[model samples]
Target: MTIHRMLARLAALAALALFAQPAFAAECLLGAPGTTQRVEVSDTGRAMTVHVPGGVDRIRNLPLVFLLHGSGGTGAAMLESSGLAATSDHHGFLLVAPDAGIPVERGFVWNIPGVPTITGEIPTEDDADDVAFLAGTIDWLAERGCIDPDRVYATGLSGGGRMTSWLGCVAADRFAAIAPVVGLRAGNPLPDDPQRPDPATCTPSRAMPVYAFAGADDTVNPVAGGGAGYWQYPMDAALARWAEIDGCREEPETVAVSDTIEERRYARCDGQARVVGRVVAGRGHEWVADNEAMWMFFWRYRH
Candidate 1:
């Protein structure tokens, strides 16, 4: 072969090798099971912890669940305590735990729309839009983590739970289902009556399936209502509003989930959507959701 021809061939080979290396690295980052990494989600410095239990060579079309943390909490803390990571490992799904943009003390809190945060600060235009961040996370995972866009779900705790409900309200089309623990909401409270949910604040584009878990003894977000500006109404009011939105048959049924766990559910709704709430007796304002049950519930829907 001529020296010039050989040099051209070597250049082409080098270019191919150069281009292939990053692709392989990205695949290894995504496909290796039990591997966790901290990723900067977008151009912004907002951090996210992603656990990819999928394949490197072939995309798994795996369901994705965003495990949001409570206020004054970080994504790492949520990943460690929520047990949803292990659940994802068992279920063969991708788990993403992301930090909210607003820094609070040692952690962060979500900038829920039109509601004051746990720090009593109402978000303005300057605050990072958490809803967009999370919704964008769906796109991110689909591109890099072998995620199924139709099977995305979200579950969160405390402030994070309220964020989950807000996502259900605003981004229902993106998520198949939502389970909010300890912080269920239907937007802000009625200006006149703080004990009722404001219907106009949260208008879902379509029917959304909701399963909320709470504790009977939790004074922070009591089922019967009355808390901070963001949590002014009872959990029942939120459920009822969602029931009304889903066009569920009125007069929900109450049953015993167990000797200590009580469930009230609204069924026969539009698109077969159901609104359910479970209260654990002697529990408090903390993470008490059954993770397996949440995955089972999430497994039912696909957008």
Candidate 2:
């Protein structure tokens, strides 16, 4: 680990130890572990389904992960498809699958501040603040002693993945890390180029730990780019941009992990952090992320 990263982790651990106690004494708002509870966020008029592991207490200083569904998909659907609850059960963390606020035909799409969605709809400031809603959810859970506020993380599919990327850009301090699947962008594409991210649109408060995933056979949100107005840059460009944002000094390295999965990473980073990703050879535009693999990346960071 870089000395800077080691010191940051140590400092964060000290802060967590000092501040996490009072919240731990409070009763958690959700049902006990081994069960799932659907929660309504009355303020945002959206909902989330939360789950914890079987054996851990509500106050175990656990890691928290948010799973975001694709466009026209619900949080419960994401939970079922990602197979993440099972991984949480085995690893002992809190999991919440949250819905997008804007209602589309069958489901919802995120209200990313200034960009248009795949539906070709641009979000107005009047729309529900999805970013605030997500960050607020973490504060609410921490208040109820339901999760470790410092260990919070997020991951999502398709449109949800774009939302995940947005969070890493604007709410880097609020979330320790983020993983966006099938849909990853540093920011809205530059208007002139349409194939490059506009740097001004995604300046984060910190170097966010980003692990992204895309499938080789996907057509909807192709890894090589060119799909919707919202998706114009290649997946590698997105990863490379994040690697630059994270101050990684080395070129990305790729290794064939297996027939289906190819692992790529930028390991020499400023804070002992890595920008990592996977490309699934045969999979398409679907939830093909390894839940275990994502959780492993998430646990390495803390707010």
Q: How close is each model in CA RMSD to the real structure?
A: 5.7, 9.8
What is candidate 2's lDDT per residue for 199-241, written digit by digit as tens?
8898998888888988999898898989877888999889988
What C-alpha lDDT does candidate 1 achieve relative to the native structure?
0.86
Which 10-residue window in model 2 sums to the lowest lDDT?
Answer: 21-30
| lDDT (10s digit) by residue, model 1, range 218-279 | 88899888766678789889999999988998689999989999989999988788899999
Our tally of clashes for model 2 stands at: 0
Estimated TM-score for each candidate: 0.88, 0.89
Model 2: residues with Cα > 4 Å off, grouped in runs: 1-25
